[model samples]
Target: MTIIRRSLGWCAGGLALALAATLGGTSITTAAPPEADPPAMEPTSATSTPGENYVALQFGVFMHYGLATYVKKRPWDYDPHEVSPLTFAPPAEMDTDQWMQAAASSGAKYVIFTAKHHDGFALWPSDYTDYDVASSSAPDRDIVQEVVDSAREFGLKPVLYYSWLDFYKDGGSDDEGNYHFVASPEYVQFAKNQITELLTEYGDIAGLWLDTAPGKFDSGRLQEIKDHIAAVSPTTAFVPNTHLTEKRGGTRLAPADVLVHEAELEGDLPCDATRPHEQSFLAVQPNSAGWGWWSFASRDTTVTTAQDVMVELMRANSIGGAAAVNASPGPDGKLGLGNVNLLAEVGALRTSPTAYVTIDDMVPPCGGTLTYSGQQTDSDWIHTRGTPTGGGKWFFGTRTHSNTVGATATLTFSGPDITVLFEANPGHGIAEISVDGGPPVAVNTYSATRRQSQPLFERHNLGPGPHTLTVEVTGRKDDASANTFVSLEGFRINASANPTIVPVANVE
Candidate 1:
């Protein structure tokens, strides 16, 4: 959740060098070991818990407006304390109603507003600090209250985001520019007091989205904060953005009511249905100037299309998780017209005919449904075995992979089109896919970094009828790949229908 500016150039040189160093200049690849049985998929009940209710609100809009929005500086580029409080200005035309209207039109069920960011500037007149709205140009207004009221008016639940790494007050950095935060007694009490105000003042909030940089705080302090929240608002779910499976070096926040995948930083993975999960991404990429997170001057022209948002939403829903798309307001305190328009389009597409099938529900050609936690039955796939990784890494903690050349997995289904989801990593190989015995398409499933449940192959407009889709292992790989491995996670179709495909199940 640290908003570091990053380039879009996905070069693998750095990862290659790091991997070589880790393995002493030799490539070492390990396939998932075979599992004794597949796990059964669990169904959620009608009367769900708070966490499940949060997940049922499948799409949300994340508002990241704060002091950094006006300054146009990368969030982590400079010490936040150095920024003057006078720089925090929003025009009188600023309207939270407009923001909530855009969110509602986009079919978002909830809104996550950044009540306080890493700069430690509070949106409300907090009793704990003067570095808040009371000291800003808009001293007469309370931004948090406005947002909460507007969200409720628009029939959307409001969720507040609070960063625990407050750079303006409690956190400091070493000479090398690595930020650190210790949960001192005073700091912990200050956080508790502020949180108490938020929970008690804001009536019926849906949840609190807590964020911190890796290695910032100890577990005991986090538990203390959790205990305080539970005591004050037992109904508000505690969501921690710890990036559980990603290589960020911090202890996982234990006993979280919900987990999050910062999809922009970590690859998109399936959600663990046992607990609610959220996958968040920005509505636009970093501007050409490389400013991070919030919207800047140049960001208006670079918004992601509605189609892109629809794809992201579909992927999130297919995996039993919610999607939180961030749309930062500009310095003028208005959302970009482009983002609003695209979101509306996404709303329209949501009502269209789109279907998703997990691997477990897929009926194989050999007349049995695929199961993740039970004995394997006759299937169209050959030379593939169910391999178990961890739940956070793969669907159902298992994926099917084959290393043999000429291995194939065939599916006969009736649909306008289909997209194959799979695991792409340094060890994966190339695959040749064909539809209805049509032309073969080459797909290279290799990445310097491991990505799970990635949509690697997509086919469209195959005419209306039952068609055979085949995936053949070519036993070839990119030069950087370590081995000839091919893995499958799940599949999605453009239209709704029962298909002879595999279901992607949840992990423990």
Candidate 2:
């Protein structure tokens, strides 16, 4: 927000006003810029393997630190002069290691730092520009390096957010200078230079989170950047921050390993991680508005509690992805009270492995259509669908529905030590179960209260490879159906069920 000053007392007299003309122009108006056409999205390649897991580093934090924190500004809001190489300095109390420890304390798996923002200030000592943390006074050190080092100490993967367009530095005060670099070969060279530094200096980096690349740098130039990264850090991943939808539409992204969806769930200070895409997110939930320092005393957002973070994090686990939340710090390099409190509460689940289960390689063979009524009442069923991992009980999907006073579907199977995980969704009512179509043994569908991500584990003993099996979803009392996403990720078969249970292992 630009600060404005007004003069009301009055323009004294003509002569007095003439003398005061240097002070103000009554109503001077600047010429409006031409209406440029809307963003013409350059065609981007879509994922060929759609509907598959595209998430790896799903749950992490986007650290919006640096000068922006010092001035209660957003990453792109601060001026380089405010904390430039000439004027920048760290507080004597600053200890980045402790901050990373605190975040690790909250159970995050990785950290994505804003190494460079739209504001154009470099967090590390960049030869690309002089306006950076190195310009700070006293301890003229590279802030980005410190944070990355700290992340390493905490065992959290470090990803870099390198903004291709700068609002400051190179653009200086040209306003549109940062974005108008479409044809400027200089800007392309500038970007490659910085990327070269990032890849070479930061060894063993997890990935690069590229954002806001100007139109000037086309696919060829972008590919150059990709090659540069690979040549410098072969093991590191390349993840552009298009943050596009999960569905195949509108530039879904080409060679990206991770997808970003930095969005708010409930009570959140909204930010735009959203783009022109269809699927809500490929992975990585958007951080709250409280992500950075705000210059207001207004109630920021309180809806997202620690439990909320946990629920989101667990959901990421279900989808085989991760979550990156935004926790904008105050100007003084400290987490706001709100974030600190929330993380502390979620600390309970930080290291609790039982809280999550990973499901992959589904091999459902006898699976088919599911329905409610008619002569073929959804009464009987047996299905298997999955890709094979090592060997184990895969997550089960209850694709059947009921429409009667009471409807039920049951399955009987003969397999050795195969575990089936049932997660009752919203429509799934209280249910009773039976194993191997044996005597009716009751098990709650467990879809109420503590039902956010309801789950249960069942194991059965069968033979070597193919085994007959069945499952029954019996509706009781009142009829209801949960048309919810039956989370079926984490699949664990007994270690003993290894080679014997792996039916697909020998598939050609």
- Each model's lDDT comes to 0.65, 0.46
Q: After superposition, how far is residue 411 of candidate 2 from its true place, in Å?
A: 15
Q: What would the TM-scores of all predictions be?
A: 0.61, 0.56
Per-residue alpha-carbon lDDT of candidate 1 for residues 114-158, written as tens digits (9 for 90 to 100): 998876778887766656676666767788999999999999999
lDDT of 2 by residue, 1-508 (tens): 1111111111223321111123365543223222221222222234422112223333566666655555445655554443433333556666777667766767766777778876676777665554555444543577778888989998888878787766654432245544435535555556666766776687656777777453343556556666656655555555665432222234434455455444432212112222111111111112433332231211333445554554455334322345665554444555555555555555654444234222233222121111222223333322234422333323221123332333443222222344434544444444444444446554445354223223354555533223323333444433344432222222222213111111111011
- Residue 397, candidate 1: C-alpha displacement in angstroms: 30
- The C-alpha local distance difference test score for the whole of candidate 1 amounts to 0.65
Q: Name the regions of candidate 1 deviating beyond 4 angstroms.
A: 1-48, 171-177, 244-246, 249-251, 285-292, 298-300, 354-508
**After aligning candidate 1 to the native by TM-score, how far in Å is the CA of 167 from where it should be?**
1.0
- Candidate 2 regions exceeding 4 Å error are 1-57, 78-87, 171-183, 214-218, 244-249, 264-303, 350-471, 474-508
Best by lDDT: 1
The candidate scoring highest on TM-score is 1
